[model samples]
Target: MGIQHVGEIAVWASARDGNADAFAELFDLHRDRVFRHALRLVRSQHDAEDITAAAFLELWRRRDAVRVVEDSVIAWLLVTTNNVARNVSRSRSRHQALIDRLPRGMYQGEGAFDAVDAHIDAEHRETTMRGALAQLSIADQNVITLCVVEELGAAEAAAALGIPIGTVKSRLSRAKARLARLAGDARAAVSTTGGAL
Candidate 1:
């Protein structure tokens, strides 16, 4: 193993031994990467920060079960970030559904302001993209997040995913094609309605 990898593994080992300084060192090493992955998926700074925190907290909580693909803890941290993002998305969907069921007039006021067309369009596109992503199988989503979004190498992604490299390659290709098609269809549907639900 490379010196850097060896050092990282050592740091994790220290953290596992209840060394606060070592744990802090590990967090400092990985905080930005974990946060960036979360931001890419969630597109919100605040939510992404929460996801990052949760992932690290889970890393500490489940230190014994941590997987070290390529002799690094990054893969595990990234996967945990994905899981946390999924949970956040699910909770948001549930809240939105509940709000949709409520009387719309209840939240409207006499001075309620309408969003600009650009803002409306942006929200429409984001919703469309989210819908498209939601349609993918969890496996497809995970592969895409690692190989496509995070730009991890195919072998590394395979290791993290616990799948063969060829499987990661093929799944990534298929997932990208499917996502593009689904996003296009979603966009078309939204445009036909003039960005309104």
Candidate 2:
């Protein structure tokens, strides 16, 4: 094996043996990548940070069970990040539902409205894009997140997802088409409602 591969294996071995510094090194190496992938899924920096943290926590918790690929644990971290993001999304939706059901004016006025108008507009666009992504099946979402958003090669995505490359390609194709359709529908709706919705 190459020198880098040997070094990575040593790190993994140390991490598996409960070496905190070694694990921290691994975390430092992959945290930004995990955060970026989480952001692509959640579209909020705060939420992405939470997901990234959770993924690393999970990595430590399941260190012994991790499957190292290509002399690195990044693939496992990515898969765990995806799962964590999904859970965070579900929990956020449930919390939002509860908040929505609360009677209006019960919470008083403008608690977190200190954000600037431009920031609000950017947040709205991000929410709209996330909503469009939400319309796809979870499988399609995973495929698109890995292949399109994360820009992983089809083979890499297939390996990360534990599926055949052909499956990744087909799902990615369908996801792209679905996203396009969803975007078009959103535009039509906006035009029909004169941007009211």
Clashing residue pairs in all predictions, respectively, total 0, 0
Error of 2 at 124 (Å): 5.7
For model 2, how does the per-residue alpha-carbon lDDT over 1-197 read when each residue is reduced to its tens digit? Answer: 32245577788788889998888888878899999878877857898999999999998999888877667787778778878888887898898799789987877543554343236445545655676887777788778877787677898878777789999999999899989888777767766876422
Lowest lDDT 10-mer window, candidate 1?
A: 109-118
Cα lDDT of candidate 2 equals 0.78
Top candidate when judged by lDDT against the true structure:
1
Local accuracy by lDDT, each model: 0.82, 0.78
Question: What TM-score do all the candidates reach, one by one?
Answer: 0.81, 0.80
Q: What is candidate 1's lDDT per residue for 132-183, written digit by digit as tens?
A: 8767887888888888777889999998888999999999999999999999
RMSD of each: 3.7, 3.4
Candidate 1 positional error at 90, Å = 0.8
